[model samples]
Target: MTPQQRARFFDAAAVLFDLDGVLTPTAEIHMRAWSELFTAELARHGVQQQYTDEDYFRYVDGRPRYDGVQAVLQSRGIDLPYGDPSDAAGAETVCGLGNRKNAVFGETLEREGIAPYPGSLAVVDRLGMIGIPAAVVSSSKNARQVLEAAHLLDRFPVIVDGVVAADEGIAGKPAPDLFLTAAERLGVAPSHAIVVEDAVSGVAAGAAGGFALVVGVDRGVGAAALTDAGADVVVSDLAELLPAEAEKDGS
Candidate 1:
């Protein structure tokens, strides 16, 4: 759809944002960490093929850590035990590898702090001024940490993240449970909420949940691909959906 056509769908009373790529630029950090971890581990196992950003988008972008590890490994015909979440980072198990990745991500975050995309913050602030509530719906257990680091935690009153999803037995994106849970916690029906996601799996979940609007933020994912995944509208940035007046107000 054209930008004008897409702008009409942003009028929902509630907005649910994906934390990593949509609000913060941590997805690049994540991609880097995943590449390093996978490249080293795969080579350690005598697998010569290099890990690439495509591997991240295809296997890990919207999945919970262990789920992502398993998916990527399985794609390469590698198998590992599904160890418990408490497993140490050094353990050669699925959960351990996930833990290792989490450690790497945490280190990267601490070493180089994070900030919300200016456009995202502008739109989020505008939503509040307009009396529209917003929540965060993400597949990362580190969502809270990332939000806190970026000082964006308080902006979102409800967060349906990987940790909450795991504790509540809600499935991750590509399933509608996580987004549905966020909407439920926000006291809104799916039809009254807008879901802003950058991942294909996430857009699919929003569409499957029958939300009022599924907005795909095209970070690296192409518009056509996001559209095929059920994004009702696709924008290069959230600011694109804001009114000229809101932009001026933010400025």
Candidate 2:
């Protein structure tokens, strides 16, 4: 979309955001952790082909942890039991591998910390200035920790994350349940709200929810792919979505 077109598009009553790649750079952290865990596990299983960043986009990105593990394994024609969430990291089950990945992610996050993407932060600040409510809706169970670590926890009043989804038995993205739940919590209809996401599955979720707008943030994921996934518009960065007048007003 053109700058003006994006500006008008985001003049929404509420905006639901996917936390990692959309608002922050933790997607890199997640990619790294997934690579580490899958590399080790695949090697242990004598799977010669490597797990690359491409796999993350294709199988893991934007989905719940266990679901991601299942998706990636399925790609290799590998199947494991879907163990309970409390399964140990070494249990050799889907949930176990997901938990192991989460462990690696948590350690990396604590050691290196995280920060919101500058462009995303700018757009969010501007939206706040205009009194448009925004909520964080992410597939990560660590969404709260990531937000709190970035000192952005208070900026978003509602968070619908993997933990909440699990507790509520809501299916993860590429389903609309989580986003729709957030919209309902915000007292806004899907048709009046916008969803900002940087993952294809997330864009699909937003589109499935029948939201007023589905904005795809291109952060490694191609703009064309995002558009194909049902994004109404795609921007190189959220900063591009900020209005010129808002930018002039210190946005």
Candidate 3:
């Protein structure tokens, strides 16, 4: 979309966001963790699928923990038992592998911490100036903790994260339930709200949810990929979309 087109989309309604890649710069951490766990485990099975940075964003990012496990596992042509949530980490169960990945993700976050996208924040500030209420929709149970670490918790009062998704029996991204729930919580119709994401799965999910705008923040995946995944607009940085309010209002 052109710059004017994107601005118009934001002007139409409240915004809903995915936390990890769009707001907080933690998507790379998740990619690293997935690569570590999947590479190590796949090596044990004599499989040689080299997990790379490119693969992470394309296949697994923006999905729930267990869904990520499934994506990586399917990539390796391996099918493990869908074990119970209590399955031990590093075992041959969906939950176990997912839990193991989470351990790695947590360790990485502890050391590297979180960072925010100045450009995205700029657009957000403008939206606020115009009275557009934004909510967060993420598949990570640690969404709140990460936002707090980044000192951005004050920006969003309504969050639908993994905990809420699980408790509400809502499926993860690409299913539209989670995004839909966030729009409902914000009292905005899906057709009148915008969803900003940095994952292919997330862009697809936002589109599936019938959001008025599905924007892709391309930190890694090329703009073409994001576009193919259903991003009505793809941008290298959110800064390009910021209007004057966020640039010089000093808010």
Candidate 4:
């Protein structure tokens, strides 16, 4: 990265990151779990349409679990009651389907452990060296578990995730509450902190929160889409934010 590009991050008071695609490859696991749940649910309901990756980016990715379930179900014109969070996995309700997906995710995670992306870890290390605090702001209830599995839980001192959002009545992404809350917890102003995310909804939340910088990591989502969603800058990996010399030194 150029000195100017690196300065954008080094000048920030703090950095807030989306846990899944940004820090770890768990987004792939999430996509698989969502596909498994929706494919079976659609098949059982005799729905003519099939679940696709497009559906994930459009309705599921980056949102709270039950909200994603509700959005996808609405697309298929299937209206299930918004069941209680404690509902059984197979129950015919929104929260039930979400819990079912979470079950699959847990099994997969346990069967095969996860690791943080090398590039993301590089950025985190660089940020820590520069004395900039960092936090995780994710829409997933499993954010803590994923971080622990990846051995990244200690890197982020503050995490604002789905459980906290639910308990505090904070709205999810595309509403700015999650990112704003993270900045607040970090004792940083929105205009002084940066948000790094791979999901369009997350980029929108950072933008809506008026953060200093909104960086979109294009794991799979197109650059154009992230730009349209309000990312101030877009890169394929977090390592690109570091100076070329710094990356080599870290290596």
Candidate 1: regions farther than 4 A off: 1-10
Model 1 residue pairs with clashes? none
Q: Give the number of the best model, judged by lDDT.
A: 4
Question: What is the model-wide C-alpha lDDT for candidate 3?
Answer: 0.83
Give a tens-digit lDDT track for model 3, residues 139-203.
99889888888888888868999999988899998888888998888887999998888888888
Which tens-of-lDDT digit does each residue in 39-132 have in candidate 2? 9988888888889999999999999999899998888778789999999999999999999999999999999999888888988887887799
TM-score of 3: 0.92
Candidate 1 lDDT, 128-159, residue by residue in tens: 87778899999998999999999988888899
lDDT per model, in order?
0.89, 0.91, 0.83, 0.94
Task: Give the better candidate number (2 or 3) by lDDT.
Answer: 2
* lDDT by residue for model 4 (152-249), tens: 89999899999999999999998899999999999999999999999999999999999999999999989999999999889999888988888879
Each candidate structure's TM-score, on Cα atoms with residue i matched to residue i, is: 0.96, 0.97, 0.92, 0.98
What is candidate 1's local distance difference test score?
0.89
Which structure among the candidates has the greatest TM-score? 4
Please give the lDDT score at residue 124 for candidate 3.
Answer: 71
Worst 10-residue lDDT window for candidate 3 reads 242-251
Q: Which residue pairs show backbone clashes in model 2?
A: none
In every candidate, how many clashes are there?
0, 0, 0, 0
| Residue ranges of candidate 2 with Cα displaced over 4 Å | none
- lDDT winner between 1 and 4, please give it: 4
Off by more than 4 A, model 3: 1-3, 244-251
Quickly count the clashes in candidate 1: 0
